[model samples]
Target chain A: MDLSPSGAWLVIVVASLGCYALKLAGWAVPARWLEGERLQRAAVLLPIPLLAALVVVQAFAGDRALVLDARAGGLAVAVVLVLLRAPFLVVVLAAAAAAAVLRAV
Target chain B: MGIGAAVGAYGLSFGAAGVTAGLSTLQTCALSLLLFTGASQFALVGVLGAGGAAVAAVAGALLLGTRNTLYAVRLGTLLPVRGPRRLLAAQLTIDETTGMATAAPEGLAGTAFWATGASVYVLWNGATLLGALGAARLGDPGALGLDAAVPAAFLALLALQVRARSTLAVALSGALIAALAIPFTPAGVPVLLAALAVVPLILRRRRET
Candidate 1:
């Protein structure tokens, strides 16, 4: 489980290759195989939970504990900006700024 | 064009966040160059930053990158080219490019795809280099709240995908699972396990159909 700095290169190479392979598999795999309703549905549905989990982990998780730190404030700002229909850049920057301001105060 | 710029702009955050997460500037820029997908890149660095194992980090990133495969499936029929061009097409089959390409008029789809992909590629990589160098120079990233910004970026990325009720349900379920698992599981395990939240939605869709 432990990864040294040098091992990171291996991870980077492996992940980049794996991701590229996934992208290529779509192009190379038979169109018929992918056309199945269930397969396509799964493809479309998969990212939802993964992304949501990422948001939760990034915002709330800390050292194996669910700690609501400054990151939560940042995410709250991001939610508001998303609700207000802010552009992606604006939402991200605003969240960082909000968290920074909160920590400063 | 505007969309490419908007998505490219986020590359700066990726750069800063990557360095803040302890990646070398070269490693950070290499991610934008190679992985290209924002969420996957972030997941990799995010896990590494949290002191997770490399395997878990790659697993999370690869899971996030799976959507690009679906994007390629949809784009394969639209832009038909072979040899090296197909390789290039696969590399460029990301969210912004696919979105732009799919939405374009039939004759213009190829142009849309290439232009958006190229612009995003250039701007994203360029911004990544700039952001990484800039972050490296910054003595302490926490002072600028970069830690908080990383999750914020994830939220921004997720917002576009949660349009429908089922997707919302899946997202909430995933969030709940990750939150519950955080206390007991390792750093990236929760994210991977939360993907199981989609199983219920898939079952429901099959039943309704």
Candidate 2:
């Protein structure tokens, strides 16, 4: 957590501008590139794996160690609830409640 | 509009997480205002909360934000705007807005995008402030186990998305890569590298062809 306030600001600024750049990049490209096979494939396949990566890292990794605590339990519960097709808020709050209750016990 | 506001609840979580990760209240609100993407905002705060590097945070957010680019490309033709107007569309070029625009009947694309985008932006940012203030008052976040909320939410989303065979394969592969890589690389690196699952996807597609 050595991030100075300024350093955090820098990251935010860059991320915001980078987002704008991506949006502009879409418009800047000829319509052909968007229709091209390679980009299309990327658009389709990239999010699945990328989102999976995010879920794995967030769920499993804790302080550089993979610890299965309440978070893991909560994640499992959330997945099951989602499979059961619960509402979005119910899924989220239920997961958190599961984690909190598990931690308390 | 209700969906937009519901998505806004994500802002509440971001506000809390950002504070837990050591950002000032002003800074957290500033992120909600400027970055305005839930996943990216969460990535920044998540990486930092886990003591990951700032650069890694930015990289992860940028990676996730690329989805908006895809949205933009798809929405570009449908939205009839240019110059300054195009900028408005770009600012609103997010998952919800693009989704709304795409699903709208015929000529209603512009109305759908603008309306949903405006509601989400306003409600999400407002909810962020309220959540931040509440969290700031709650003192330490660990007491309530709010730390678990982010990963749990992401897990819920993954569960919904991974119903198909191809998605399941990619998700499992990505998880394996991240688990294997965690010990050696920096915190966020493994997550980004998991995108290498794309390689196998491409190879499979080629073989099918």
C-alpha lDDT score of every prediction, in listed order: 0.86, 0.77
lDDT of 1 by residue, B55-157 (tens): 8999998888887888888898888868889999899989889999999997898999999889899999999998899889977877788888888888877
RMSD of 1: 1.6
What RMSD does each model have against the real structure? 1.6, 1.9
**Each candidate's chain B TM-score?**
0.96, 0.93
Query: lDDT score of model 2?
Result: 0.77
lDDT, model 1, position B32: 91
Pairs of residues at least 3 apart in sequence or in different chains that clash in candidate 1: none
Worst 10 residues of 2 chain B by lDDT: B152-161
Worst 10 residues of 1 chain B by lDDT: B1-10
Best by TM-score: 1
Candidate 2 per-residue lDDT over residues B1-209, each given as its tens digit: 56855676677777777887788888889888888877778777877767778888888788778878778888888877778788777877887888899999999999998999898888878888887887788886655667667776666556655768987898889888888887778888887888788787777777787
Residue-level error in angstroms, candidate 1, position B129? 1.1
Clashes of each: 0, 0
